[model samples]
Target: MRVDSRTLPLVPLLLGPVGALQLPLLGGSSSASQAPIAADKPLISSPLLQEQVKAENLMQRARQLYKIAELGEGEYNHPTRVIGSKGHLGTLDYIYSTLTNLGDYYTVSNQSFPAVTGNVFESRLVLGHTVPESATAMSLTPPTKHKEPVYGQLVAVANLGCDASDYPSDLDGAIAFISRGQCPFGTKSELAGKAGAVAAVIYNNEKGDMSGTLGTPSPDHVATFGLSDTDAAPFLEQLHKGEKVDGIAYVDAIVESISTTNIIAQTTGGDPDNCVMLGGHSDSVGEGPGINDDGSGSLTLLELATLLTEFRVNNCVRFAWWAAEEEGLLGSDYYVSVLTAAENKKIRLFMDYDMLASPNFAYQVYNATNALNPVGSEELRDLYVEFYEAHDLNYTFIPFDGRSDYDAFIRNGIPGGGIATGAEGVKTVTEQGMFGGVAGEWYDPCYHQLCDTVANLNLTAWEWNTKLVAHSIATYAKSFDGFPKRVEETSISSFAEEPKYHGPFLRQ
Candidate 1:
């Protein structure tokens, strides 16, 4: 996630006025004593092309979109390339091109936001409990200019690693040495500020490199240098022995304002009174072309949009291509915040497609019961089960961890669900055994790395998953009123409920 907790506002309501409708009952003649046979409608065995003129047209357009996206496979992070403008400008261009090409298909709206880029690093501490070599800052750490070493007394406090309450008010002039146990680095910094600490030193509770951001600065204070536990243990021990500890946390302030876009397109001739939104981030990470990371989801929706454009949808369908997903779901979050209460009421669902195609990977569904996290939605669970059975596809369900765009939509009470192909570093044993791929491998070897290129893409995997997304999207778009049937909501307690173990997803 790029930006922490920041979000763009939603576009104003631009949908046209709804017209009135009327339904009438025709008179029937009295029947004789003879029994009558009823007409058996043909099964909807295949995609109905004639009835789905729009779907066919969309598919035709999708074929073109897919080709264009293929050309952009390794270009996800190129500023001059198709995916470079991950923040806003690029999203606007894509949306503009589609809207302009579609002309009267639907109204187009643009929402603007500020882009902030900061130093992001992963600090690593050596295996030893007291080795300096074990501790290193993330590569993206900002250059600390030649400034005086800011020092203070080191204070070790539990639960203060990332929340605002972790820091003590009396430690205003002291250095706070905290433990990295739960939450994110950004969160730890937020807590440090509340504790009145001048600088924060976070040590690892467990052995491993710590990757994430040291929270962004508030208007009141600046946070810098989230240290590894191994590196800070010596000083922290001294503090524990009533000895004062001091160190520097220098930060070269880098802040900039930039623009990004949200590409939105809608279908015509549907129940304009209600609408459903399907979307994914169009931007990739700063490193590689996000061909698999998100280009899969973005392209899948693009293709789905192409199909929906020509089909006569029963409900209004809005296709959104968001920017800055790598930045903490900013684009989609912004879109959600800006919707009026009335606008929100009209939304039927929000289905997000993110990283839908991994070369050869498990098909995982989000929204399931877990012994750890209790975020499973029964309505969504059944819908996925039904879809899989209807399509004769195999899938596995995992607990939702609020990691994707669906979080924002669900926050507003909109039912949401989608698919994932896979990614590096999280593959299942079954996937390797069946697909002849690496077992115990990352779902994607190139995730967030420089190697996430077109060559790394698995075309077969992409095609199969793309079809799955298209089918689900089309199914939901056509039958919004009948899907995501309501399910029981459960409360979240401690983390014990979340499943710590991993299993095969999308395996037969």
Candidate 2:
């Protein structure tokens, strides 16, 4: 960012030891920094922690992040912190460096894992002579090397294309048309390849267009791409009319296996046995800057961690910045999967922060009462509600679906709770009355588009939601008073829902 006229302390000096080096952190007056922070004292309280969360600091951090993503990420510059991008690497480096700079207060580590990374060059579908511009080639799908748009008869598949029986016997050398649901996108592609289809096209069940991934590369999979229901309507009508529908599908992408890292940091001063954990994913979709999608969430955690170094907590507060969440919650799933049953029990609770800021926004809380959650999750959820209600803010409860990074924690029977503004989901008229944004628009109109930059954020919503996050950190760091014991086996049920969201958007 431009350093003209305004010289502010970087992350290290945001609020120096709470008072001693007292600089106007976030433009606060000198007295604001000098308010009761000492090394020997047990500084743990909701108001005290919440007091440090400033809009100016948040705005400053967001601008820095926005600038990082704007200049482009990796080799292709298509990386908005997606796996294997330089931008993703930059985010990891920033988090690790900042936490490590806090002296002995935190134990920071970088855990690396291999993940399949891909960058799409071109993905398009052609019908007759018209090209549907909105159709996006599914990530990791095979690139069709055809120089000219090839023509093949279009045959629509049945039953979501999961079973082999759904394909027709005569569908050879044709494009397999399918609807998204009931199965993984890769499974559909494999089935189509075996059924003799040259390429596959999947359309969204929802109103807007979607971007999808095959999870990883597979030799048996055919070229595939995802489209909106609206874009594929014309071809479907022609096929039903007993008319010819010639199509060409092409996808150009560079796919490979590469190493990626997840950042984990924990305060050393609290009780390790009853550790309180919270985090958000750091990866974005290949399409945009992802500032609101997870940048807002990650920045909130970073700012809190910086402020937290000055305070002492009764229970440990651990923070994680997950990688590859946009590719199916890979980073978090990997972290939880390797934990021994005993190691999992050490965590008293886990809270997630995914999308805390959206252009058209309303406060959203995770449903801790869902059957899939652990016992003490409801109390954490209630605490978030308490914060909102105390401030006279309206909120709604989103389902504890496997769409977010919290999927792993809940499945392992850890108490998980979270707060979000939203992503992709349309705002209801009721939400419109509560938050005053456009009713029929997406909670984030720029959900996964190139438009999701610094200008896309609703700063007022971001400031409010981030303070709630700080309150949760402070409350749980102090004590787990009304929480129940973790006597149950990991969890109630697994995440068996169809069409799991790839980070913020539903993957076909």
Candidate 3:
């Protein structure tokens, strides 16, 4: 998604970027800084001593949970396929089991929300129009009964090219081919509808495959289909010649109740009057166990929850395990939308941990609005750096998007920031030197695949990341003076050019 320039802060003041930092601090050396560092207050002397002790105990318990999850998670079923059809029982059971391990330290409630049902429909231009080897089914199309042949004349429109205004005049009862351009996939489809076209197909203009969402429900009535560049080439070419063509929108639709939830487990003794939220999503794409896609983040949050269960801090810390994040942050959206004005005011911060255990990942911290980290947020990042320095780790910062639960908090004007291991297509060769890995493949090949089970975890990175995350949380809870009343933006673009540091400690 293209964020407006106004929404991103400058580059040097790092925001949304991710990476792996050097670990295992040497004596007198800090993990976050180039030199030895010490916190203004001792890690244990903070007002949240009880909480720190509880957190340490929770870490031990987390080891056991990891062992259990490792034993039970695997590819007996393809990851995506497993989620696609199951009742939410398996997932809920996992949550229940995780909570059971926490004993009486915290309350565990089973909250269920209504499920929005949708179907997957696919179409192809075969025999006549050259068809690609693979295609995606539209998210909203109803099931199709026949796998047999179906055809229709074609209509191609340049939705947003140099001459996008030249829309086809007579497109009724004809298929429409539109080049993927400036507007959203939904917008292209809506345009096709406005032009009186039947089926709509959108193709990528860039070199790689293009993915997008359609039928996003905006009080818009545009029944349309999306296509990859490879899939639309044939029919699109025909339309370029002003010739009629035929195609199919094959669909394998599903009609079931898919319930998603956001687990909010609160810690007491901290200021219940105001709270901090640490979160990550639990649901994965209908592909794999999502161990890495989010299982890493999910597990980290769970571990954090376990650690903070009985701890006492200055304010309440709520660990939220969200569901349906892959579905465009649905679970979090619901949570935020439901909060009252009073409830909104009570929230002081939201820290998101989306992906934090990839061996191939880069370190990133996000601050809301403009890619650069806001000044107040930068101070928090500095504190994190101090933690790293105290532990002897290397780290960097970049621009960010509050694309998770923190987003809701930011939208409501709450302070927030987060760390990510990494995701598809962001890390570069410089990062590879520091983190160690291939330069261009997906951050975690198992991201949304069935292989995202326990065994797939990068334990070294996992342990280090979890520790880093814990340290960050513990510090923030104990030291944050108060939420910033206002944050001035900073420019950080030049920081991107610093020859990404890679020393003996960096690894892929």
* Top TM-score model: 2
Give the top-scoring candidate (lDDT).
2
lDDT of each: 0.52, 0.76, 0.52
Q: List clash counts for every candidate, in order.
A: 43, 1, 60
**Model 2 lowest lDDT segment of ten:** 1-10
Model 2 whole-model lDDT (C-alpha atoms)? 0.76
How would you order the candidates by lDDT, starting with the best? 2, 1, 3
RMSD of each: 11.8, 7.8, 13.0
Candidate 1 lands at a TM-score of 0.69
**Least accurate stretch of 10 residues (summed lDDT) in model 3?**
499-508
Off by over 4 Å in 3: 1-87, 100-104, 107-111, 117-128, 133-135, 138-149, 158-169, 181-183, 190-198, 205-207, 215-238, 255-257, 367-377, 381-399, 486-508
List where candidate 1 sits over 4 angstroms from the true fold: 1-88, 119-155, 158-175, 181-184, 191-199, 203-209, 214-216, 220-253, 368-377, 387-393, 434-436, 484-508
Residue 213 of model 1: what lDDT?
46
- How many clashing pairs in candidate 2? 1
Give the TM-score of each candidate. 0.69, 0.86, 0.71
lDDT of 3: 0.52
